[model samples]
Target: MSDEKSKLLQMVRDGKISVEEGAELLDAMDEPGTKPSGAEKELKDRFLRVHVDSAEAKVNVNIPLSLLKVASRLGNMIAGLIPGEARREMAGRGLDLSKIDFEELMNLINQGLEDGKLVDVDIEDPVKGRIRVEIYVE
Candidate 1:
């Protein structure tokens, strides 16, 4: 591997920057004449944040998409944040949290996917009462 690429990955692994930042830096390296400036870089580093609110639980997950290798682990952690009752409701609706492919999602984002509110679901849970689940890439 090229030293630049290795260094970029190391910075990501060390939590010095997010995977998106590392990828942008590597892309700048490849071009050798262009770099994401100010506003562009600011937009590139936006996060995918999840918030689940309910009478019984309030969960907030901020995903920086750091290191593609750990995307699944992050997904799992996010899934773990949802309360049991809400998880069951989500599963019954055919939305299996365990199967979410965060790596693919990251690819789409890197390719210049527009950022905005991605998901917002509000429901009445039997145990949790009024519940709302929100997922957004912003």
Candidate 2:
């Protein structure tokens, strides 16, 4: 491999640069004179995509939601211990359990796929709707 390519690969392996970032660099290297491909350009906004594969009655949420809930509870406790606007901000934000539609999740997944990043998802029972979903940085 070329020196630059090797460097990028090493960074990805070392967790310094993400797979999406490495893909963009590779695209740029492949097209030395011209601009990056549309996929490469969009990688800047890339995010991991999660989807629920079950029907409306059996929506499965990502496992991370439980962890997020725990983290939020811990954050609330910490905010109580601290003082000032940080606590207020945490209170205002609440649990931040807002849900995103499947379309948005699909868009993020497609973007990640286009940019050559690993996309992961899970299916689980729903809390209120047919399905639950989550996404993250890859």
Candidate 3:
């Protein structure tokens, strides 16, 4: 174990910190100049990654939560840019973008990351073949 990890474990044993806090602290400690394991790196990332793979095509996207926050703010600022008719049209089609709670969604994602939850989705379309999508904090 790394010295930092060992120290954290020791702290746990000494009752200086709870096991859960020690685990969180140990997870936050990554040695400089050392490559982190995939899961380890993902735990520390501020972006959410969506990776899709299939026989026909592959797509990898990394979306920063910070960018989403900025976009949400910008969208609020430009809400009036969309014509009333267009907004009503979109709402009629059941596509109401204004109803999305971006902040709440981000908060849920952040909580999931903190809880070390992994979500994997797989789809098989007759025409598209097989596709695997992995959404995780990274």
Cα RMSD, each candidate: 8.2, 17.4, 16.2
TM-score for each predicted model, relative to the true structure: 0.61, 0.25, 0.38
In the range 30-98, model 3's lDDT, one tens digit per residue, is: 434333444334333365554556665454544344333322433332223333444454455564545
Where does model 2 exceed 4 Å of error? 34-138
Which one is best on lDDT? 1
Clashing residue pairs, backbone N/CA/C < 3 A, model 2? 56-130, 59-131, 60-124
lDDT of 2 by residue, 64-128 (tens): 21122122222222223222332233335452222324335445544543433232323232442
Report residue 14 deviation for candidate 2 (angstroms): 0.4
How big is the positional error of residue 104 in model 2, measured in Å on the Cα after superposition?
Answer: 36
**The CA-based lDDT of model 2 is what?**
0.37
Which candidate tops TM-score? 1
Better of 1 and 3 by lDDT: 1
CA shift at 88, candidate 2, in angstroms?
Answer: 20
Q: Which residue pairs collide, candidate 1?
A: none
